[model samples]
Target: MNGGLIMKEVTNSDPFTIVGTEQYNMVSKMNREYRIFVSKPSEKPPASGYPVIYLLDGNSIFGTVVEAIRIQSKRPEKTGIVPAIVVGIGYPTEAPFSPHRFYDYTMAQTDQEMPFKPDGKPWPKQGGASEFLSFIEEELKPKIHQTLKVDSNKQTIFGHSLGGLFVLYTLFTSPRSFQSYIAGSPSLHWNERNILAKERSFMARLEREAIHAKLLIGIGELEKEHKSNIGELAKKMSERLSFYKNRGLNVKFIQFEDECHTSVLPPLINKSLRFSLHSQVDQ
Candidate 1:
């Protein structure tokens, strides 16, 4: 995690590359090459430097996120959104998504941990969440901190779907890793809700350590319409939201109307930016 991340400079030759953004490739300790995209605010940084947001599925959404930040943060006084650095963790592939993501975004599992599969098909090679997280904390963050003017205290992580699952996993397992978390349409039903098993430990840890962090979860209105093997995810999401709030966690849940799982991401992205970057984040 600490030593094996080797940064290699990449020239942005792609025609779709966003202006004012830089792309690079880094080899993780697992020897997996990841494409990293970064967009820095043009405005001068504050004394404590700008906040940072680490985005998953960067290849598909980096441009949207960068443009949103640039436009919204241009008039911070009016938008109530401050300038921030955006770090996109993607793969070294021309495709919008990489198959390798199935490994990076899931937790280590066993026969007992995941007793059944909804799809009834074998899952792709997975169980690398711990290593992937180490790549972020030990290899990636330090590199970013050393090279950029970012406020370590104001870090946030954003992910959607499986990546969203990773966001929640990070929060529950290592709450101090970031100040805020944005999970858009997370796959909570994965492996028969195995992720929920960790909730009790997370709550206990929060109480024992008196640690505080903010969470924002968003899902599309039509998510419940599509039936899964387990049940209606929209209801499940609501139930989990209530459970989190009841436990005295700083959390927010939003349901985007007139959208499905994929379509919800755009609005969710806009809201996520505000939720994470706004000065009054605790509210």
Candidate 2:
């Protein structure tokens, strides 16, 4: 079956709904559909409004994220960490699910075969990230702002794997777009470490100028998929860390010793939310 048909069937089987609150749904605009999950305070919308966390690959991670929020909000001491809304950009279960995402998440197309794809399908469309970023900034953000009681300055963006790569893209290209960024197991190998090069360029262009935002990067200690290249990745990350520190950017790195690529999401999400939440209090 086609991807759209599969999505329709899945939605029919298990419709979207907010678990604890009376708000949530699959929103559609301009041929794109997204699953938005919201969690509002019991009293009502606060005068200051709530913060939002936008998660890429929402269909896979929304439940775990929502559960984490529920557990965090129950604790009196941790109430500050729970965000008001967790928007998940749902993806169809097929090739080129969303042309925008497929393009944005990938790096530049290459002629060489990928380690993950042995059959070699022309490197999956990529390099339209600037335009994809525009879609979120110009289209999606406005929709959320108008519909929800969100604190304009407290928005965060998160991603994993290829999605994580795009998070970095946004961070460098549009640093002011999000107050915080969470990247879990990002594919730093994209475009032969083009992300690292871009970071260098960004730092060079803004030397000694502080970027007022929080960045958290996490990786599984046991993620040895490309064993020979692991040391290089660590070295690149270390270099980036030094650069960010010199620039006075708020940053954190976590290495989960027992986790793998797929296993890193839950803990990463928990830690990222905790960090973002605490930063709010510190401000």
Candidate 3:
């Protein structure tokens, strides 16, 4: 043993900070632990309560989303956007991502969608979007409600790529869970486009009951050639979503010409915030 060596636990501080931010840990029913970061508005909440945005992939982009909210939302009069709370949901890991995302974000795989490993290794087990949605709706939301005054009717959720795929899954399976859903470059080819089946089911349900939600879908133009399958998938999703416009839904599709999959995220966050809060202010 080395002499004069004192070993003690090191207390690490969060690298990202937003005013009025709070951090917590939650364990889901599936036995997965999550890292949750939340930031409420600096100003007093409106009579309607603070709108909340639930974001996936929070491990990597929480700071950027929170920062954007802080800069533009500080003065809503100037920005035409209202102040709201941001809730980032991430996994408890040092890395920016986890392979758990593959299972958590994707639904059941079909025979045609059987994943082939790069080295011809065994395929990874997948399909947990349903249970993950339950964790959000049943456990996570209630926990947040206990701490903050949330306008439940104005809730929104945002995700990108695989997480984006989960957002679409959530909207189709439980349309009333949130007021707005934003998917940025969703992996529409997931499970061999099984989400299309979910879409048909969603439509059937909509026939019996009314649905009220706003959906904003955006993709990076450069991703077309880079993600060849996405071109067809996005087109299909666009067409399917368009059918719901007259059935009490607001749908918008945008392509960010200059941005690629990686670079398009900031604009997606900014645009989602505006889409959720701007029109509400005017109304």
Candidate 4:
């Protein structure tokens, strides 16, 4: 099938048969409609609850994610990773899409011009991240939890570029949103604002009550001029880690030496998944 859509029929006697793919259309508080694709493992009975990975830019990465999860499910020994459900959040279009993602993902919006606004319209109208988090906490999470047998404690959020910015934002602003965060080539340069602000603030107010999480910040070593700027970014990220050194949070920063902004995600996803899983197991 196109887009790798696959379906399997199961008999009543077969409890371990693979369930076919399913699609969902959800409307946000803003009345914005989003298409979500969910894929589950081909296993049986106790409806084996699995981990959930919410992927941003789902339309672009959904197929890759599904394949990756399938491969892992089939060869856990080779991948050294556990099979999980991938929740792909898709946008309507690439441009108008920014506002939806920005509103949902950002903690706050400054007076920065959103990249790739074709109409140049005032963007990010609904940027109260708390509301978005509420949607996830009260709505999406509950829906997924009720519909699928998933480990509530094993939720992960994965994003790239601007989406990466949102992932980091959620990590600090809504610390309990997910158990693991994977940010690839985050637009650290967004709005000329430093994510460190949130990091530092969270550090000051951090409490043991916060959900423990694994934070993986990935960057393309070949991004931009490959000069002092990259070094500075890494240094600042390190400082954040230093601040939380004795805290319960687990943070890992990686620089792919040969990857560029556009090319870093594939490798980052693979490495970040393994790292996050390993860290989780260690804990």
Candidate 5:
């Protein structure tokens, strides 16, 4: 949050920009250069410092999240949204999303585990999720902490699609890394639904020690209708929600009406922000 961004003018020649947000490039230990975006609230930080939300697909949604936080957090009493730092991790690409996400957002899978592409094409190079998580925990986070005051106990991570799958992976394997998670339309069916196996281990860990973390899962109602291969995402996700609830995890599940995969992102991003930051506003 301490990264300084030169405020650029919003004009025909200059193009528009998010005023309070900063963007920088950092290379991971894996030698992957990522474009990092940070947006800090104008108000002073609370005694416990500001809650932080790390977002996947930074190039696509960084401004949306920044403006939502800027507008809604101004009146916490009415909005129930608190001032928080937003960090978006993405790639240095002119396009909205980089193709490299397939690797960064998915678990390692054997050739047999991966389903063939519908177009009869070979899959992109993938299965670098472990390294991606390492980059976040070991490299990116430490740099952010050094730059700003963040509430370690209130850290939240959010993702959608394959990124959502990574969110679940982080929760199951490294539950203590974040205090809350928001997974929107996760690709649970990936890798032959291997995430189900990870859930079992996560439950076992929870039974042995108390790890209080909040999870919110949201899926558009028409997801199944839009994508044939997904095969009843709402039903599958609901089952997972039940499993987490039975294990005594704090969780929330929502199915947005008439929304499909692409159309659901904006509302899901807004809902995720409120879900993660609302309760902490009064505290």
Candidate 6:
């Protein structure tokens, strides 16, 4: 393994330790630095323009999802998936994930959601989701759209765990921000089911402004233990989705068999991608 050192050539664009992709460090006014990756498909985009998937936790899942899209989309006659651009929203850090993800990929909270240490130590700061969402809407989206000729009407966003929570939050608040939303094993118990309130508010918005988008909610069958909150969380999500499905939101629920919370992501990426783009390219 060359003593854990990379023996291959490296470049600034390949900073994510992956090839065939470009990485950039974007600094925001909120003092958060995002390590972004743009992975374009190998084949030429359709005349309708290429679809784009904005991924949270870019540093960890970017490579997996990007490669999945590339491989699956290679043979459309066999795999229904299509080649699309993947925009990963990661942070600059040697670790697998940055501490800032706790804050940036969460909903605004009031209480009952703080993470405390065993000895009751101060938890990491959180609840900066609004700001992070603004960064994506104002700064990141414009930058990406300006550079690439993307099919904005086919935009998709994928997130896992806490990032999944953020995906739901974004969908509820600004449904048009993306055409499809995939939330994998979301931490819905966060803030004592605070996301429900957001959904309630979104219901009111739906009355005034209609939304047309696809939503995929997936969770590992083994994600819940005896005392786990995942079951209740999923119930709330499913119930809420029931109300929105008739209002233009096409939703799907998947329970991955024989997979746990952490192990489900790699496998879910491919399925999520297909679900996200199926309707767009099926015609």
lDDT of 3 by residue, 126-177 (tens): 8888888999999999998998889998999999998888988999989999
* Order of the predicted models by TM-score, top scorer first: 5, 3, 6, 1, 2, 4
The candidate, 1 or 4, that scores higher on lDDT is: 1
Backbone clashes in model 2, listed as residue pairs: none
Where does model 2 exceed 4 Å of error? 1-17, 20-43, 76-80, 92-100, 110-116, 228-235, 246-248, 280-283
lDDT of the candidates, in the order given: 0.82, 0.68, 0.83, 0.70, 0.83, 0.82
TM-score of each: 0.86, 0.79, 0.89, 0.78, 0.89, 0.88
What 10-residue stretch in candidate 5 is worst by lDDT? 226-235
Shift of residue 87 alpha carbon in model 3, Å: 1.0
The residue ranges of model 1 lying beyond 4 angstroms of the native Cα positions read 1-16, 112-121, 229-248
Residue-level lDDT tens digits of model 1 in 70-148: 9999888888788899999999998989989889998766544443457786667778888999999999999999989
- Measured on C-alpha atoms, candidate 5 has an lDDT of 0.83
Candidate 3 vs. true structure, TM-score: 0.89
Residue pairs of candidate 3 with colliding backbone atoms:
none
Error of 2 at 154 (Å): 1.1
Lowest summed lDDT over 10 consecutive residues: which window, candidate 6? 10-19
What is the alpha-carbon lDDT of model 3 when measured against the actual structure? Answer: 0.83
- Which tens-of-lDDT digit does each residue in 1-283 have in candidate 6? 5988879775556324555689889999887888998987777778878899999988888888877877788786688787888899998875678888988988666756566777898656888999999999999999998888799888999998888888999988889899988999888877545788888888888777668988888888788762457745865676678677667887777878888878889877878877876665221
Q: For residues 167-278, write the lDDT of model 2, one tens digit per residue.
A: 8778876788998888787777765556766777777755846677777777887776555454247446645755575555666777877898778887888788787766
> How many clashing pairs does model 2 include?
0
lDDT per residue as tens, model 5, 146-254: 9988999889999988888899889989988998898888887775456777777887887787777888778887886754444366356556655655455677777
In model 6, which runs have C-alpha deviations exceeding 4 angstroms? Answer: 1-19, 113-115, 226-228, 280-283
Indicate the worst ten consecutive residues by lDDT in candidate 2: 21-30
In angstroms, give how far residue 99 of model 6 lies from its true place: 1.0
CA lDDT, candidate 1, residue 270: 90
